[model samples]
Structures are given as structure tokens and as C-alpha cells.
Target: MTTAERATELRRLHAAPELLQVVNVWDVVSATAVAALPGTRALATAGHSIAATFGYPDGEQIPLHLMLDMVGRIVRAVDVPVSADLDAGFGDAGETVRRAIGQGVAGANIEDQLKPLDEAVAAVSAAVAAADAEGVPFALNARTDAFVRGRDRSLDTNIADAIERGRAFLDAGATSVFVPGMFGEDVVARLVDGIGDRKVTLIGLPGVPAPARLQELGVARLSYGPTTQRVALGALQDLATSLYDGGVLPEGIRPLN
Candidate 1:
């Protein structure tokens, strides 16, 4: 497709009525699979996925240049719109959002993580402004870490904080509010309901529930967040072990790599 066509598709996707089952792809190969899926309307990349793939940790271990290069590869390998997890925006929010748009991503998941909630909001707001300045219809997934954080706050307190942070972030021009690490059904429902038709999303980790279950929970979108790479690596390890220890290929076996 032409550049204008691609941009139009990416911007129009957020308006989709059906819940988007966005998988976290780490490389060109997985991005290709996700792009080929009939149900896949967009692609999301994980920060931890880039860290693990590059033999680093998740705390911004992979630099922006490297991550942007990998993102470019995946974008080139797929036709769908891509939204990347730019963990903590890797710096201030404005530069983070601008750099991501510079790399051709349609959107980014900016979290109120590792810093005061106010700073996170400021950062995301700056990012949104930057993206807008560039004439890109940037979608910012405002993520709160009240539950995801290892703080000693009670669930009630954390929920309150998350809701408060969610409201502030949304007011700061966030395209959507994403409450990651809220895994419980009841908790998910509360967050989704709290956001209330403002295009909220949740991180639906694998083994949490069936996709139908998430859809039933009023979730507008779901992101896997790099579990697919771990799954694939484990499967590849087992396949190699079968070739080494089993001493024979199983029936109808073919190359996994």
C-alpha cells in the first residue's frame, strides 16, 4: 500500500468496533504471522521482548536506536498498523513520542512507570504534543502502574490511584487508558468500566482467560506483551531436543525454525 493508505489504515483502526486482539510480536517473523491473521487489525511490540531478544534486561536495556531499527524491520515485514511499547518512553515523553513517530510507529504505550505519576503524565503529554506537532495521529496508551507496582498499597487504594491516574492521563490528551497487570476478572471489569467507552485496553496475559472471556469483559483491546516470543523459544528448544535426544522425527514433523 502507499504511505498515505498505510497511515489512513492505522488511524482508522482505533475506530474499530470489535475488540482488537493485538499480539506482542518481537521480530519480523512473528509480525508477519500477526499481519496474516484475519482477526489481527494491528501489531504491538513489547519492551521486554526487545530486551530479551537482544540479551538485555527490560529496564531500557535496549537503546532507542536499536529498538527503532527492529521496529522498522517488523513494520517492513507487515502491512498492518503497529503500536510499540516504548517502555517509560525511554526518556522524557516528548522525545519518546517523537522518536517513535520518527521510526514510523502509529502509536505507543506510555506508562506511568518508574517515576511519580505526575512525571509520567507530563512525559506522555509532552509525547502527545510532539506527535501532534509532527502531524501524526498518535495514539498514546496511558498505562498506570498502581497495581503493577510492587508497592504495599491495598487493592482498594491501588484501584483508586489507578482510576485517578487514568483520569489525569486521559485529560492530558492520552488516546486511550491502558491498565496493565490488572489480571483478575473483577478487577478488569472495574478498570474497563471506570474508563467507560473512552477506548480503554487491558493487558490480557496468556493463560488468563479465553479471548471470548476478555471480549465479554468490555475490553476494547488486548495486548499479549511478549509472551509469544517466550512461547516460541520454548517450543524451538523442545523441537531441538527431540531431534537430539529422541533420535527420530515425530510423525508429520517438519522444521520449526
Candidate 2:
């Protein structure tokens, strides 16, 4: 599909511009399960999900090759679009961008945690340039670490930093920027307000609001990083145990084919 058409399709299904919902699928089964859900239009890989399934935490543990293989399977399993959750982009800025584009992915989450801010900006910028050079519509959801560690950035300071990062990313041709782990309606309102008209798409998550709530705040995207992973586990656990424990199985529940 054309980039503009693809981008527009991504938007209309999402409804809030860059505001898209993502499910962390660790395997093909998970991908298939989520693809059946009607509210979702895209799939996002969780580095943590890959690492955890491989007996590691989310901290730069999973090999990029392994991650890419899983990403490939997710793409194969569903007809919808897929984005790689490349933690810290997995390399220097340029390589990060290059690898993602090389993978035939539509978008990625590149963070600034593992490097200094200036370096991170350069990397993100190069990645964006790479996307442009490839002539593909790639989305880069820039992840800032300043707010994650609770390093004392007030709402305004955080907003200012995000706007600066957002501007740089947009200039680099990034499709959008994701600010994770932030909450509170007022804070979200301020970020959208502060970035008025610059128009770099904004995404926040792990605590993104419901559709109605996010629409009211003017957020362009809402991604639920690992939330679905956690809940799905809870769901199957609840289901399997309910029958075993004689906990209110509904009518026609005993068809063991």
C-alpha cells in the first residue's frame, strides 16, 4: 500500500491520529488471538515479552535476530500492520533506523535511555533520515527516559523536553513520538497544548486512557505496552481454573471435543 494510504488507514482505524493501540504478542498464538479482536488494527512487539519468554528480563537481553524472527512471525500471522518494539533501537541511531527499515517493518519504538540525550537525538534523526531515503512511511515513537526515572522533571519541564525531542524527531521525519509511563489528565492536556500546531504525533502508554478519555485530551495515540500480555495471562488463568475449581461454569460448558 502507498505510504499516505497506509498512514491514513493507520489513522482512521486508530481514530486519534498517531494514537494507536498495541498488543504485546510473544508468539504466533498470541498474535492470532489478538488479530481476532476487532478494536485493534496494529501489533507491537514487546522486547520484554521476547526476553521473558527467553528467560530474560526486558533489559536489553534478547538478541536482535531472535526478536526479528518473532516480529516476522507476527507479521506472517496477521494481515494487519506490525511495528517492531526495538528497545533503544538496539544500536546506534543510524543502525537502529537502518535495521528497522531493513526488516520490512512499518514503524518502531526508539528510546533515549541507553545513550545521552544529544546522542539519542542524533541517532533518532539519522533513523528518520534513513526512512526518508528508503521512501517508506516509517513511524518512530521516540521514548524519553527523563520522566521514567522520576528525575524531578516537573510537568512543564517534562513538556518542554518532550516538545524539544518531538520537534527534532519530526524534523528527522519520524512519524510519531511515544511518551511512556506518564499519567494524569491535566498533564496530558498540557503536553498536547504545549505542542500546539507543531504537529509531531504524540503517543503515551502502559497507562493510556480509554478511547473517549484520550480523544478528549487530544492525544494522537495510546499504546498499551505489556498490559495485554499481563491481562491475557490473567484471563486464561481465570478461565482454566474456573472449570477445575467448579467455579460457576455457564450452560453448555462441558463440550470437550
Candidate 3:
């Protein structure tokens, strides 16, 4: 399918009755793995994972061109729709989104942090408009960092702030609102209730219930972020340690046939 078609499909997946579970990938290998999964419907990139693979850090530390190249490679590798987590849009949200659309990204998660709320809204709106101009049904997942940045504030205040930003993002043409670092059943429920009809996206957190439980709590989507990469790296660390100690190789490691 064309990227436009893929974008349309991704939007439908998010708006569908069933929950949208995205396994964040960094490269073609990971993207191919996720695409081959039985239940996988689409793909997303974890900025931190992609950056780390290139020996950089997340938070826009990687160059935009390099990130776009990585995303383009993944898009070329997978048949399923792919979404990119373009952290702060590499200092130019609109331009970054234009490049992403050109690279065949069906959707993206753009975080609203390190910028004023109104400015962020305008940037997000520009992305939405750009997608429209290109005739791609792009799914714009606008993220707010209130929970992480405002933890010192009261819960009610944080919820209110989230709701405010979420509403603004939705109004600005974002397909979904992501409140990362917002976990717990009660907290998730509150976000769902407070956000009303708009789709609420939650980042996966340790000890949090599975997607089944999250769906039960009214979450529209769940993403693993960089946790999958961390797990894979951790396993590699254990393997190297065992090898250094002259211990038996791990079960999963085997010479190519």
C-alpha cells in the first residue's frame, strides 16, 4: 500500500474498538521482528533506542537527518504502518514532520516539552495540516509531559494540566493525546474520564497492568517506548559477562546454520 493508504489504516487502527499495541523498534531488524508477530498491526520507533543505536542519546540529541534516515530504513523494511517518535521534532516540528511524511511514516508521536504550550500547539497543528496537504491520514499523537514535569504539583492539578493540554492538542488536530509517565489504574481511569471522547495514550510503565487491563481502564493505545531495547541490551550484557567468565553460552545464542 502507499504511505497515504498506510497512514489511513493506522488512523483506523487507533480509532478501532480494540486497543492499539505498538512495539517500539529502532532498526530494520527490530521492525522486521515486530512486523512478523502474529498480532502486530503497526510499528513505532523509540527515539531513545534509535539514538542509542547510533551512539547518541535521546531528547533530540541525534541529528534530524540521521534519525530520518533510520526511520526511512525501517519504513522500507516493514509492510505494516510505521509511526515515529520525533522528540521535540528536532527543534523544528513542522519541518521534521514534513520529512517524516516524505519518509513514509504513517503516524508520529511529538512530545510537547521544552516549549510553551501555545507554540507546541501551533507546531502540532502545522504537522496535522502538512499531513492533510499531502493527503496522508497521519495519526498525530501529541504528548504532554505534565506528569513528569509537574509531579510536585497535586494530582488534581496535574490532571487538570493534562486535560488542558490534551484538549488543546485535540483541538489543534492531533489524533491522540499522550500523557507519558501517567500510570496506575486510578490515574489512567481519571485521564480517560477527564479527557472525554478524545483518545488517550499511555506509556508502558513497570508493574503496570497489561494492555488487556489497560483497555479495561479505557486506554486507547499503549507503547513500550525504549523498554524493549533496554531488555535486549540487558540480555546482551548477561551474555558477554557469561562469556568473560568462561561459562556456557546462553540458550538463545547459536551459530548461523
Instruction: For each candidate, give its TM-score against the true structure.
Output: 0.90, 0.81, 0.95
The regions of model 3 sitting more than 4 angstroms off are 251-257
Candidate 1: tens digits of C-alpha lDDT, residues 1-257? 54335545654665466667788998887788768879878899988998788888887888888988898788778878888888887777788778777777888888787467768778878987898798777777888777788468788787777878888888888777787774577777777677656366777664455667767776667887877788889987988898888556568854423
> Can you give the lDDT of residue 236 in candidate 3?
82
Candidate No. with top lDDT = 3
* C-alpha local distance difference test of each model: 0.77, 0.66, 0.87
Candidate 1 residue pairs that clash = none
Model 2: CA > 4 A from native = 1-19, 196-208, 237-257
What candidate 1 gets wrong by more than 4 Å, as runs, is 1-12, 206-209, 250-257
C-alpha positional error of residue 148 in candidate 3 after TM-score superposition, expressed in Å: 1.7
Q: Once model 3 is optimally superposed onto the true structure by TM-score, how far is the C-alpha of residue 59 displaced, in angstroms?
A: 1.1
In model 3, the number of clashes is 0
State the lDDT of candidate 2 residue by residue for 1-257, as single tens digits. Answer: 54434434553544444345576677777788788789778777777777787777796777877877777777667767767788886666567666665655667778777355678788788777777787766666676654675457586677777767766666665666666655677766766676543232334454545656766666666666666677777987998899799877567753322
Instruction: Report the lDDT tens digits of candidate 3 across residue range 100-151.
Output: 9999999999998836788889989988988888888899999998887887
